[model samples]
Structure formats: structure tokens, C-alpha cells
Target chain A: MVDLDVEEPNSGLFVKGKLEETNPVYKMVPVWEKDKCTFCGNCQKVCNFNAVIQLHTQVLVFPKLCHSCYACSELCPTDALPMKPEKIGEIKTFHQDNLTFLESCLNIGQEMAVQVIAHTNKILEKDYQGQLIIIDAPPGTSCPVIEAVKDTDFVLLAAEPTPFGLHDLKLAVDTMRKLKKDFAVIINRFGLGNDKIWEYCQRQNIEILAKIPNSRTAAELYSHGKLIYKQIPQVKQEVLKIANKIRQLSGEPK
Target chain B: MRIAFTSQGSTWNDPIDPRFGRAPYLLIYDEETDKLEVIDNTAINQVAHGAGPETARKLFQAKPKVLITGNGPGGNAARVLENANITIYIGAGSLTVEQAYKKYKNNELKNY
Candidate 1:
């Protein structure tokens, strides 16, 4: 029931020269008490991610294995476990020229990305004053991705034109269908390999949101951690066009 | 506390038949009397999905403080039982309710 209303600027959710901020959303994780811990290994046993482990003398926890399910804390017999406050991560608002960028960093060894993504979602779900929010999601259809899509206006799935890309994209598509989230495809690296991606999208009736050609310049710029601005203006322009198309699909004005 | 082993029959009135659903009887172990009474989940026969959450709730509500069952409650149902602080013995399998209760009393059932 915590209120998540924060503003993130630009992020391409708004038109050029428009100012914005994402709403603030808070995400929390559970903390454990070691005193009453009997090293019973219950948490380790139930955790699907191997996030918890028990050694000869003590139980060990890997934050990455934690899905933040709270099953362990709830099932603890000795009242030795408690929910501790944890900030999984957060997104920062950045502007790369006319494009607003949402730079999100998951805290090192953080277990739950969903919480942080949900917090980010709070901003996107709120009043945008007629702007488009482009979400660059972490790959995978698990809890993290699911949580990211919650409250999204629309999902523009970015996939490369490759066999592995097709495989993962199908899984992502299935997840979107299961979640009933409306989504479109932005097939990057067009003209690289096969037409299987196009055929699959056609079979599924998924709209082609946009296509980015397999450009070496774009790839090089990305590899160097440089923004699209560092690359040729056309590359930035193509991404902006994709952003505009996303805005149109989202039914947002200008 | 007499705990009932419920698998086949609820009451001792009928033969101890190891049957599915209806055959399952409740093992009521009365610690005070030191006598174990096996009854039917018959009291809850009218209820749908017998041996499910509703029955699990009723079993725990009888104030046994612990239950040894072939299966464990899932989702929020499990959470409810755990919140009530009921010690659950999952994987009771074919073990008679009586045998399971004895095992619990002897502290032989390992906790997860």
C-alpha cells in the first residue's frame, strides 16, 4: 500500500524540450535475524534460485537467489527472522539531447529487480502530461520482467535479428500474452540473417513497431558506452523515430 | 490432545478401509487421555474439496498445535496455517495418521 509516485525526466516519454520527472516509488526487501537462526536450512531448501545455502556451522544467503518471496521469514519457527528494509535499486533521470534516458542500475548482489522496477513503474503510470516512456527492459520473462511491465502503457520489445534472439523473443512474447500485456516488436539488426523473425511476428499478428538496421557505427558507439549523440545523427534520428512510433501506439500526444 | 488419522474412514463405526478421499480418517490424539481416536473427515463431507484448505484449516483449528499430513497446504493457505503457528509435517504419505502423530511426538519428523 505504499504510494509510488516519482518523476523521471525526459526518457523519451516526452517530446523535445519538455521537462518531466518520474513519480517516486518505493520498493522494499526482507531482512533476517541470525541470532535465532538454527541454520535449519529451510530458507535454503525452499529458495528456487539457490539464493540460500547452509554450511557446516552457519547458513549463508546469496542476495541474488532471493526473489523476495518472504516465505522463509514467514516460515521461521524461532521468530528469529524478520523483514529488514532494503532498497533493491532505483532509476535516475537523464537527458541525452532530446531523448530522455532512464538509467537504472541494480544494486550489486541485489536479489529482487522486480521491486525496483515496480518503483520505476510508479513514475511511468502516473500523469505524463502527454509524453512517451520508452522502457529498456532487462532480458527474460521471469518476475523481474513481469514487474517491469506492470502499469506500462505499452511494451515495445527490442530484439535482435538472430536465432537466439528469436528464441528468447518467443519466450518474451509468451510471457506478454500470459500477462495480457499489449506489446509491439522493434526488430533491431534487420537484414543481418534470416526472415524467421518477420515470419514469426506475422504468424503471431504482432505489430512491427520499428526496425533498426545492423549498423556497425551504432554497434561501435554502444560498445564504447557512448550515447547515440556520439554516433552519426542518423542513428539517433532512427531511434527517435522508434520512440515516436511508440508514442503513437501509446496514444499519447506530441 | 488426541489426534485423528484421517485417510479412509472418519469414524471407527465402519471398517478401517484405506480409501481415497472418503477413506481418509482424522487421527485425533488426546495428550491428556493418552488415547488416540481416529475419525472421518465426515464432519466436513458436505464441504467441497475435502482434505484441502478448508479441511486443513479445520484440522489446525481443533487446537492440535501440530498436524502430520501427507500433503502440505500451499499459497496463502499455508501462510495462514503458519501464521497460526501450527507445526506442519508434510510428506506424511502412506503413513497412518496415528504413526505420523507418534513420529511427531517422538520428534522424529525433520523440519524444513
Candidate 2:
């Protein structure tokens, strides 16, 4: 499983593995050179981020504010603004038996997550042509989620049955439709909320692959960082049902 | 000396907008000229990011010596104004544009 939730990646905690490899990822930011600068004010004008400011004495560059668009560097008249790589995040690989979990994490205080997620997608998954890859996408159908699910063959949306859940689920479904991607839904904490979710899904013709029941035992096990399927029969059955549906979708019928 | 304020409306009696980045109007009071200039700032709200900084960029172009807003501009906006040698006085959220100016004169506002 590749966890693309770069902001707060804790998917690896569910799986036991030894750390295999770690790689740092960087994004480019403009650095100002004092001597090379001609006080042209070109860099400041070109920067949409307001990251580069030209004062009377010297030029100022705010590293955190830069979006790494390279506009200032490319447009600088005197080559005062040059692009430099700044570490933004890291990718870590863990191995246990036949499972390889790739976890990518964005460094704290970083503004962007697309680079880290895109980099994570490029590594390892390319060579696994026939293997089953389960991706954990970031919450919300925004830019980060777009970067995570854009390349996937299928998207499985996990949502609770609350009013908030129905709202977000509708958004995700709309986003998937807009992206022209085939997707399914899995309603979690199924019994906890009203039947509005069901009514909405039925009206929309959205196929629900599985419904994971809300159980005290499952919640307890999950809180303890233990896989609920191992101890709870009801949860295990639902997981198996979802796996079978996935197999049928993959055309690997058992 | 000229002072800038984020205002809800174009008039001096309008309440000051605490949010500098997405304020409806930017009001500049030119003490030297005994005049007030109000610029529409609704355009920058449409920007995807850097609203604070972009607003600051526009605010700096007017060359205000000091900024009086409800709450101050955020870090990104603050940096740009600071670099431009503009002083920021905040905690004017409850006051009108004219009242905020009075507070500024009386030194009742907190300098941010």
C-alpha cells in the first residue's frame, strides 16, 4: 500500500515493517545575489508571491513564501534571482514479508504537498504492473487529493454516514465524475448516522462496495493501533466482501 | 505623513475591516494633503494565494507611512509592509475609519 497522505502519514503504523530506504525531496526557490543585482526592481515586480522585495539598500527573499514557479529567476535582468533546491519533504520505504509500504511526509511549515505526493507516486509503483496497489488519499477533493488519485485506475471513497459525510461524499463523487474516473464508495461507521446517505447514494446511482459497521469492539481495537479485522468477525467479513468486489473489478475472479 | 486603513466602505464613518488581506476598501488618509483616498480592494480576494502579500503590494504602492487596521495584516503581509518601512498599528476592529485615526493620534492602538 502506498500512502499518499503526505501531510500526516501514519498508514505505516498499521503495518509492521522495518525501514528500508529514505530519500529527501526538494522544491526550487529563488535566492537573491546582492552584488549581481542592479536595483532594477524586476525581480520584485515579476514575483506574484511577493516573496522577493527590493528595498533601497538590498533585495529580500522570503524562502517560505516562494511557490517555486521560477518566474523571478527566469525574468531577472541581471541573473540576481537564481533557483536553489530547498528540502520540503521525505519519502520512506518499509518492508515486511511481501508487503512494501511507501510513506511520504511533508516537512512541517511547508506550504505545498503536491511535489511530495507526485514524487511518491513516481517511486516503486511504476514497476509493479500486475500488483494490487491500495492508496490512502488525503481527505478533501482538492489539489492534494487530485495529485494523489489522478493516475489511479479506480478510486474507492471511504466516508462516514453523517450529514458532513454525505456532503463530502457528494463532492468527491462530483470530482470523480469531473475527472472521468471510475470509482466506488465504502460507507464506514454505517449504523451511526441517518439514512440520508443511503437515499443520496441510491438517487445518484453511486455503487457502494461495502458497509463497515460501527462497533464498540472495532473502535476499541482501532484506537489501540490493532487491525480490527483480526479480532472482529463482522469487520473481517465486510473486509472480505470488499476484497472480493475489488478482485471482480480487477478481473481476477476467485 | 500618510496612513492606510482597511475599511468596510468608502466613507470615513465606515467601520474598519479587521482583515487587511480581503478588505472591501483600502482607505489612505494623507495628512500632508488633508485628503483621503479610497481604493477598491475587492479584486485581490479572487487571487488563489498570497492575498495578504498582494494586498500589501498594492498598499505599499500608495506609500503610506503607517498602517491602521482592525487586526494587523498576517505574517506575509506584515513582512512586505515592514520592508517598505511602514508602521502597523492593530486592534482597531471595533472602530470606524475616522475613530481608528483618532486612536492612532491618541496612541491608544497596539503597535504590531
Candidate 3:
């Protein structure tokens, strides 16, 4: 399983593994040479994000504000600005029995998760292929989620059986539809909230793959950092059923 | 000096639009000639992002000394306008474009 939730990846908690390797991820940002700069304010004028500013004698570059579009360097008449790599995050690899888990951890106060996520995928592309890769994506239909789900074979959307769940589920559905990816819905904490999600799924012709019923035991196991599927046979069976369905849909032999 | 007012319509009596970036029309009032010219803002409807900055850029090209609007030239737009040495004035809500212009000439509106 690859955990692409660079902002807050927690899948490492579920598996007992040996820390194998770690590597830092870096992104390019413009570095200005003051002596070469003429204070023309051309860089400032061209920057859409206000990342560059010129004040009388000096040019200021805000590294965090920069999107690293290379526009400033490309447009600079004096060739004063040069690109430099700045460390944004780290990728860690863990080894457990037969499964290899890769997780990307973004540095605190960093706003660029997309860079880290893309780097993680690059590592995955180089090292692994033709395996059961389950990506634990960040919860949202935003940029980060798009980065995680892009180029994937199928998407499994997990939601609760409530009004807010339906609202967000609708958003996720819209995103998946726009991306034109094959996807199914899974209701987490089922039998507790109302059946609006089920109704909406039925109305939209979205397949309901599995329902993990709401239970105090599952909650307790999670609180103790234990896998509920490992402790409860029924939960394990439910997970197995979901796995079988995925295998069937993907046309992979189990 | 030329001044720009955010207007819902092109006429002199048109209501001052509360929105700066998405305003329907920009009335460029020339103080010297006492003539008002309308520039339709809705022409650039295909912008995916940076509508405020794009509009500000267009206004900057018009060489307006001052921009009189109801609410905002948001952070991005404000930066571009400031860079171009154009001053922004606010508090023209529920007033006509002509009324906003008159208030500005009389130094009644608050400068942002």
C-alpha cells in the first residue's frame, strides 16, 4: 500500500514494518543574484502570485509564495535569477513480510503537497510495477486528491451514511465523472446514519461495493492503534469481500 | 486625469457595481473632456483564474489615476493596481456611477 497523504500519512500505524530507506524531496525556486540585478521590477511585474517584489535598491523573493513556474527566470532580461532546489518533503520506504509500504511526509509549514505527491509517484513508477497497489488518498476532491487518483485503474470512494457524507460524495462523484475514471462507492460506519447515500447511489446508478457496519469494537481497536480486521473475523470477512470484488472488477486472478 | 468606476450598466445613471473584478462594465470618466466611455468587462468570460488581476491589468492599461469601486480590488488586483501607481477608493455602495464620481471629486469616498 502506498500512502499518498503527504500532509498526514497514517497507514504506517496499521502495519509492522522495518524502516528501509528515506529520501528528501526538493523543488525548484528562483534565487536572485543582487549584484547582477538592475532593479527593473520586470520580474515583479511578470509574477502572477506576487512572489517577487522590487523596493528601490533590492529585489525580494518569497520562496514559500513562489509556484516555481520559471516565468521570472525566463523573463528576466539580465539573467540575474537562477533556479535552486529547495527541500519540501521526505519519502520513506517500509518493508513488511511480502508488502512494501511507501509514505511521503511533507515538512511542517509547507504548502506544496502536490510536488511531494508527484515525487512519490515518480519513485513508485521507477521501483514497482504490475502489483496490487492500494493508494490511501487524502480526503477531498481537491488538488491533492486529484494528484493521488490520477492514472489509477479504479477508485473506491468511502463515505458515511449521512447528509454531509452525501454532499461530499456528490462532489467526489462529480470529480470522478469529470476525470472519467471507473469507480464504486463504499459506505463506512454503516447502519448508524440515514439511508440518503444509498438512495443517491441508486439514483445515480453508482455501485455500492461494501458496507462496514458501525461498531464500538472497531472504534476501540482504532483508538488502540490496532487493525479492526485483524481482531474481528466478520470485519476481516467484509474486507475480503471488498478485495474479491476489486479483483473481479480489475480482472485479476485471486 | 482619467478615473475608472465599476458600473453594472454603461450609462451615467447605472448603479455602482459592488464587485470589482466581475463588474459588467467599467466607465472611464475623463475629467478634462467631461466624457464617459464604457468598456465591457464581460468580454473576458473564459478566464479560469486571476480574474481580479486580469481586470486590474486592463484598468492599468487604461491609465486611470484612480479606481472608484464599491467593495474590492482583492489582494491580487490591489497589488497590480498599486504597482501601476493607481489609487483605489471605496464605499460607493447603493450609489450610481455618476454619484460615486461626484463624491470622489468632492473627496467624500474613503481611499483604500
Candidate 4:
């Protein structure tokens, strides 16, 4: 299992794993030399993020605003801009039972979640030995989600049965269709809200892979960092059924 | 000198647009020839990000000496405009594009 939620990775809280290693991710940012710079303001003009600024005699570079595209450095006439690698996040590897867990955690105040997520995905692609890899992607239909789910075999969209959930689910479905990825919907907290989600799924011809009922006991177990499947036998059976279905769909030997 | 104004319509009688990046049109007035040119800005409305910076870059290509808009440019666009040595004037609220340009010419508009 791999968690690509770099902004807030919480899978480690539930799984008991031994931390094996951590690797830092870095991005190149431009550093300017004041003496060599003529204050022509070319760097500031070329920068898309307002990372570079020329105020009177001094030029300031805001590392946070820098997207590290190297446009400023490349456009510098005097070659005063130098690229420096700045650490943005870290990827942690762990061993839990027979599964190898990889999680990407972004540094505090870092806005580059896609970079870390892409780095994590690259590491997985190079070293992935498992037949079936379950990736827990970030919640959204934005760039991060697209980066995480792109080129994957199947996308299991989990959502609540509320109106907000349906709205977001529709967006996710639209994104998936646009990306042309095989996907199915999994309604979490089922029976708690109206039947709007089910009706929409039916109307859209989207497959409902599984539905997890809303249960106070299951919620309590999850809050305590306990697996709901392990606490509830019925939930365990449902999960096993889902696993079987996935294995059958993916053509993996059970 | 060339001056640019964000406008809601293509003509001089159109209201000054409050937005710098997502405005429907850019009304460029040339002081040398006393000509008015309108550039469509509707393409920027569909952009999800970096619209301000892109618009600033487009304006920079035109080499405008002054930008007279109803609203101040965002941080990204401001950097691009400042780097290009283009002075920005604001407070053209609820006025027509021609009125805004007239106010800017008369030094009645505020400079940020």
C-alpha cells in the first residue's frame, strides 16, 4: 500500500510498520548574485510566480513563490542566477507484515504537494514488486489527484452519500472520464443520507463496487486506530468480497 | 505613450472592468496617434491559474507606458508590470474606459 497524500498522510497511524528508510525530495531554486546583477529586472519580468523582485538596488528571491522552472536563471543576461536544491518533502518506507508501505510527507509550509507525490510514485514504479498495489490518493479533482491516479489500473472513488459527496463524486467522475481511466464508485457511510448518490450512479451507469454502512461501532474503532474489518466480522466479509472482486477484475490469481 | 485599461466592452463607452486579469477586454489607447485598440481578454476567463501573469506578459509585449484599470494588479502581475517600467493607476471605479484614460491623462487617478 502506498499513500500519495503528501499534504496529510495518515495511513501510518493505522498500520503497524517498522520504518526502514527516509529520503528527502528537493527542487532547484534560483539564487541571485547582487554584484553581477545589473538590476535590469529581467528575472522579475520572466518569473511567473513573482518569486524574483528588484527593489531599488537590491533584488530579492522568495523561495516559497518560486516554482523552480529555471525561467529566471535561463533569461538572466549576466548569468547571475544560480540554481540551488532546496528540500521540500521526504518519502518514508516501512514494512508491515508482508506489505511494503510507502508514504510521502510534505514539509511544513510547503505548497509543492504534486512534486512530492510524483517523487513517491517514481520510487514505487522503480521498486514495485507487488502484484497488486493499492494507492491512497489525495482527496480532490485537482492536479495532485490527477498526478496520483494517472496510468493506474483502476480508480476506486470513495465518497459519502450526502449531497456534498455526490457533488464532488460527480466532479471526480468527470475527471476520470476525461482521463479515460477505468473506475467504480464506493459509497462510504451508506444509508446515512438520501438516495441521491445511488440514483445518480444508476443514471450515469457507474458501477457501485461496494457500500460500507454507517455504524457507530465502526466509527469508534476507526477513531481508535483499529481496523473496522478486524473489529466487525460482517465488515470483514464485505472487504474480503471486495478484494475477491478486485482480484477477479485485475486477473490476479487469488 | 500607450495606456491600457481593463474594460467590460470593446468600445470607449464601456465600463472600466474591476478585474485586471479576467476582464473581458483590454482597451489600449495610443497617445502618439490618438488611436484606441481593443484586445479580447475572454480567453483568460477559462484559465484555471496564472491568468494575471499571462495577461501582464501580453501587455508587456504591447509596451504600454501606463496601465489604467479600475482595480490594482495582483502580486504576480504587479511584478511583471513593474519590471517592464509600466506605471499603474487605479480608482477608475464605475467609469467608462475613455473617462478612465481622461482621468489618468489629467493626473486625477491614484497611483499605486
Candidate 5:
């Protein structure tokens, strides 16, 4: 399983894996050299993200806003704005029995989670020899989540059963439909909220594979960084059912 | 001394917008000529990010000696103003442009 939520890679908290390999990911940012700069403002003008600004006597580059496009660094006449690789995030590979876990984490002040996620996917594609890749994508349908699920065979959306949950679930459904991805839903805390999500799923013709029961025991175990699949019989049954469906979708024999 | 204020409208009576980057108009008040120049910030508003620094860059081109605004500039915008040698006086969000200017002169505004 790969945790593409680099901003908050919490899957490591639950998965008991021994650390295997670690790698640092870097993004290029234009570093302004004081003496060589003519202050011509070309770099500033070329920057579409407003990452570079030419003041009266000095040039300032905002590292966070920089998308690492290399426009300013490449177009500089004096070579004052040289491109430098700055460490933005790190990737860790772990092993637990036969399962290999890949987790990428962004640095505290890093603005680009998509960069880290893309890098993590590259690592998974190149290094890992796993047959079935389960990707735990970040919540919401933003750039990072899109990057996570873009190449996946199937997406499993786990949702709570509430008004707010239904609202976000609709957004996720819309996004999935727009992406033209094959996906199924899993209603978490099933007995808690009204059956609006179920009704909505039925209307949309979305297949709900399983419903994990609302259990305080599961929540308690999760808070302590424990996996409840073994301890909680209900959660284990639902998870096993989902696993079987996923295997079937992937054409894996029972 | 030239002073810059981020305002909602082009007039002096317009309430000072607390936001430096996304303000509707940037008003530059010239002390010597008693003239006011309004800069349209609609372009900055349309940008996805770095609005603060972009707005700061525009404000720098106007050559304002000081900036008077509501909550002062944020991290990225503040860095630009600091490098440009421009002082920032804040707590003008609740005041009008004229009142902010008066407060700035009275040293009643907080220096950011």
C-alpha cells in the first residue's frame, strides 16, 4: 500500500512495518545571486507565479510560490538566478511480512504536496515489484488527490454517513465521473447517519461494496495507532469483503 | 512623504481594506501635491497565488514611503515591503482612508 497523502502520512501509524529505505525529494528554486544581478527585471517579468520580484536595487524570490518552472533561472542574462535543488519532502519504504509500504512526507513549510506525491508514484513504479497496489489517497478532490488516483485501476471511496459527508461525497462522485474512473463506495459508520448517501449512490448507480459498522471500539483503537481489523469482528468482516471485491476487480483468483 | 493605502473604492472615504494583496484599489496619497493616485488591483485578485507579493511589487513601483492598511501585509508581502525600505502602519481596517492618514500622522496606528 502506498500513502500518497504526503502532507499527513498517517497510514504509517497503523501499518506495522520495519523501515527499509529512505530517499529525499528535491524541487528546483531560483536562487538570486546579489553581485551578478543587473536588476533588469527580466526574471521578474518572466515569472508567471510572481515568485520572482525585481525591487529598485535588489531581486527577491519567494520560494514557496515557485512552481519550479525554471523560467527565471533559464532566462537570466547574468546567470544570477541559478536553479538550485531544495529538499521539499522525503520518501520512506517499509516492509511488513510480504506487504511493502511506501510513505512520502512533505516538510513542515513545503507548499507542494503534489510534487512529493508524484515523486512517490515514480518510486513505486520504478522500484516496487508488487502485483496489487493499494493507494491511500489524500481526502478531497484537489490536485494531490487527483495525482494519487489518476493512474489507479480502481478507486475505493470511504465516506461517513452524514449531511456534510453526503455533500463531500457528491463532490468526490462528480470528480470521479469527470475523471472517467471505475470506482466503488464504502460507507463508514453505517448506522450513524440517515440513508441519504445510500439513496444518492443508488440514484448515481454507484456500487457500494461494503458498510463498516459504527463502532466506538474501532475509533478507540485508531486513536492509539492500532489496527482494529483483528480485534473488531465487524470491521474485519467488512474489510475482508472489500478485499475480496478488490481482488475480483483486479482478476486475482481466490 | 508619499503614503500608500489599500482601499475598497478610489475615494478617501472608502473603508480601508485589511487585505493588502486582494484589495480592490491601491490608493497612493502624495503629501506635497495633495494628490491621490488609484491603482486597480483586479489583476492581482484574479491570480491563483502570490497575490500578496504581486500587490507589493505594484505598490513598490508607485514609490510609497509608508503603507497604511488594516491588518498589515502577510509574510510574503511583508518581506517585499521590508526589502523595498517601506514602513507599514496597521490597524486601519476599521478606519476610512482619511482617518487612517490622520491616525498615521498622529502615530496612533500600530507599526507593523
Candidate 6:
């Protein structure tokens, strides 16, 4: 079971329970030993991303281009390829009385974030069958970000009130739409600029879940590596209210 | 005669399609005839992502007189093609197949 504590006033909500179960969606890469390799180059030949190369003296694998599909190992004729557990990221689980915290980080020099997402899902206990999952995804609209949100029930897209944020938010929204995922918006650091984002949301009929004002206290808490809800009790109450609103929208039990 | 152009994505060891997008079309222009036949290319069907060495070997099987291509040809691709002693025209994608043959006829284009 998990609990979500909101950290904004008139903008926060809280949720606590076990989330739904999702299947594992990411795969790890496999390394092949060329000693048993016949140099037929089937693995190199079948790679769509050109991750594997066949040199005259030796074969080469570029980890940056690898997607961990294990296609090379699956198709190796000589059985030279073997898959091992690769570390692309970690999942941190924090516990409080009624609040849960989870954060995911990607490893350095890793091109594919899917593996991290896979590991993140793995870290969550399957026994928690009725908890809420609140994911803070990495920024972008590419494949990595897409994979991060594959199993999400509701995505809270955080967009800043700026032209650049609007541009990238459109891409992110388009990507989510393509995936057919339900989502809402959170206008972070509100009141610093005009309501252009709100106006756009109203015109498009996109739901505005919440709006958070700029706060130095929240900034300081984040800089200190502390949860805003813990540093400020008001934020925690707000997060609980937001969670209730989300529950109402999702038709889940309060 | 079948000739192939060698480049980053071309299969210099096998007879394949020429990589057209990355470099000039490796066109074997007939001297007296304007007939053009594509040689070994890593970019067959305009797919310019990977090289096919099998394509290069296939090109060697066809045995053309002049192999015309672009710059950066001194890789594994160039070495395998040069084994046949076929005249290599570096940076010749700008010339038409007929012009390539004419330049060769006049002994103007030389191998590097």
C-alpha cells in the first residue's frame, strides 16, 4: 500500500493504497562472446539500431545504441551471446505514516531508460495490490519518457508557464494521446506569469487538476533534499485533497 | 559490368546496392553507352544506416572495370574493392555515369 501527500495549498491532494498490478515491460541487453562466434555476423546483421558491428579482427557492441531487446542473443547461431542483469537505474522507496515516496534515477552513459523503468516496476512489491502509484517521469517526449508512463493510470503532466514549456508540453501531450493514456495538467509555480497556459487548457477542454504558487520554502526544501509535504504540513494536507479529487475522477474509493 | 560505390554504409566485400543518400550513387557508366548499373552499396533501396559486406562480395563477383565513389573511401570498403585492381574514382559522385567514363577515357581521374 502507498500514500501520496500533496505539497501545495489549494493545489494539493493525498492518496494512500495499493496500486494495480502491471506486467514487466522492459528487457536487458545480452553480451556475446566471439570465441564461440562463427563470425557469421547474424547478430550484427539483424540489429535495427546498428548497435553491433563486425570488424575484420573482432566484433564490437555499442552500449549507447543498445535497447536491451536481447535480439542479438536470441538470434546468435553459435550461442556466443548471453544476457546478464544490467544496471540502468534504481528505485528509492520512502515511508511515512500515511505518505509514500518513490524516485527513479537513470545510470550514466545509458541511452535507453526503459531498463530503469523496468527495474522501478520490479522494486514495487507485487503483494501491494491496492496502492496508488505516483510517478515523476523524466522530461521529454521520446521513447524513454514514453516507456516510463506505459502502465500509468493517470499522468499528471507538469508544465511551466512559458513558451518553451508549452512547446514541449504539446509534444508530451501528443505522445500520451498516441498511447491512449488518460492525463491531467498541473500548472507549477503559478502567478509568476499570465494565465496563457490556463487559457489554452480551457480552450482545448483539457482538465486543470491543480495550480501551485511559487514558494521559496518549497524551493529550499527541495534543495535540502527534503520532501515539501514533510517540511510544511499545509503542503501535505493539500496533497491529500488533490488525492481525493483524483480518486473522485478515477471512481476509486476515497 | 557491375560496379559498386564504397562508403560508410556500403558493403565493399559483397555485391550490394550503392548508398545513394550518404554519398553519390556509385554508378558504372558505359563509355560508349549511357547504360548505368549500380554496384555494391550499403544503402540499397535508399536505406543509408548500415553497411553490408555481403553486398561487396557480390559486387566483386560481377567484376566491373571502373569503381566510382566519393571521399572517405580508405576504409575496409576501399581495401576490399582495391583487391581487384578496379580503378577507384574518389569524389566522383558529382559526375554523370557518362562523364565518369569520359574522364576515365581521357585518363584524367586517377586512383588515390
| Clashes found in each candidate (C-alpha, N, C closer than 3 A) | 44, 0, 0, 0, 0, 41
DockQ (Cα-based) per candidate?
0.02, 0.46, 0.07, 0.08, 0.85, 0.08
Better of 3 and 6 by DockQ: 6
Residue-wise lDDT of candidate 6 within B1-112, one digit each (tens)? 4444443322223232223234423444443464555543434546433333333334455566666554534344444455555666555445544454456557776566
Per-residue lDDT tens digits for candidate 1, residues A55-143, read 43354444444566777778878755566655555565655466665555556555455667665665555734356555656667776
* Native contacts kept (model 4): 0.00
Higher-lDDT candidate of 2 and 6: 2
For candidate 5, the TM-score is 0.95
- For model 4, state the Cα shift of residue A30 in Å: 1.4
Query: Isolated chain A: TM-score per model?
Result: 0.67, 0.93, 0.95, 0.94, 0.94, 0.77
lDDT of 5 by residue, A72-174 (tens): 9899999999999999999998899999898899999989998899888887778764578998899998999899998888999999999999999999989
Write one digit per residue (lDDT tens) for candidate 4, span B40-100: 8888877665667667767877778889887789877787688778899999968998888
Best by lDDT: 5
> What are the models' TM-scores?
0.51, 0.93, 0.70, 0.71, 0.95, 0.59
Docking class of 1: incorrect
Residue A26, candidate 6: C-alpha displacement in angstroms: 10
The Cα local distance difference test for each model comes to 0.59, 0.87, 0.86, 0.85, 0.91, 0.58
lDDT of 4 by residue, A1-254 (tens): 88898899988888799999999999788998988988888897888665776655667676766778899999899989989999999998999889888888989987878888888888877888445788889998998999999858899999999999999999999999999999999888878889999999999999988888789999899889998998777677667767987898779777
Can you tell me the CAPRI class of model 5?
high
TM-score of candidate 3 versus the correct structure, residues matched by position: 0.70
Tell me the deviation in Å of residue A146 in model 6: 1.7
Q: What lDDT score goes with residue A21 in model 3?
A: 93
Per-residue lDDT over A131-195 for candidate 2, one digit per residue giving the tens place of the 0 to 100 score: 78888899999989999998888999999999999999999999999999999899998898898
- Which 10 successive residues of model 4 chain A have the least lDDT summed? A49-58
Clashing pairs in 2: none
lDDT of 4 at B93: 64
